[model samples]
Target: MIVAFSVTPLGVGEEVGEYVADAVRVVRASGLANRTDAMFTTLEGEWDEVMDVVKRAVEAVEARSPRVSFILKADIRPGVTDGITSKVETVERHLAEG
Candidate 1:
């Protein structure tokens, strides 16, 4: 599964980058196949591991602020892996063929 999520602390004004970084750090430390883009951090793993990471990441941000906002999107295609990179690569390949 590929889970792309964005976590942010609410009521914290404009300075949420540090809190977001904390969440990203948790994801990185998990050593799962992951990617961090401007909007979302994508984690590739089984359902349990992926949800665990997301929960912990939310906790990291929640620690700083009383309220938090989180958004998640998941692609659960069984018998497949590396969708984080490979899915984008496949699209780019199709574009190149044009």
Candidate 2:
């Protein structure tokens, strides 16, 4: 499964990069397959392991602000591995062929 999410700390003025970095740190340290883009951080693993990381990441942000905004999207296909890079590569291959 691949889970892509973003964590934003509310009421933290105009800049929340530091708080968002806290969440990304948690994701990076989890030893899971992951990627961080400008908009979201994505990780792939079993449901329990993935959710555990996400939970801790949200908590990291929660500690900094009274309110938090989280957005998540998941591609929960079983029996699939490395969908993180493979899925994107597949799309790129199609585009190159066109």
Query: How do the predictions measure up, each by TM-score?
Result: 0.97, 0.97
- Which residue pairs collide, candidate 2? none
lDDT of 2 by residue, 3-90 (tens): 9999999998999999999999999999999999999999999999999999999999999998999999999999999999999999
Best by lDDT: 2
* Worst lDDT 10-window in candidate 2: 11-20
* lDDT score for candidate 1 against the true structure: 0.94
Candidate 1 has its poorest 10 consecutive residues by lDDT at: 7-16
Off by over 4 Å in 2: none
Q: Which stretches of candidate 1 lie over 4 Å from their true place?
A: none
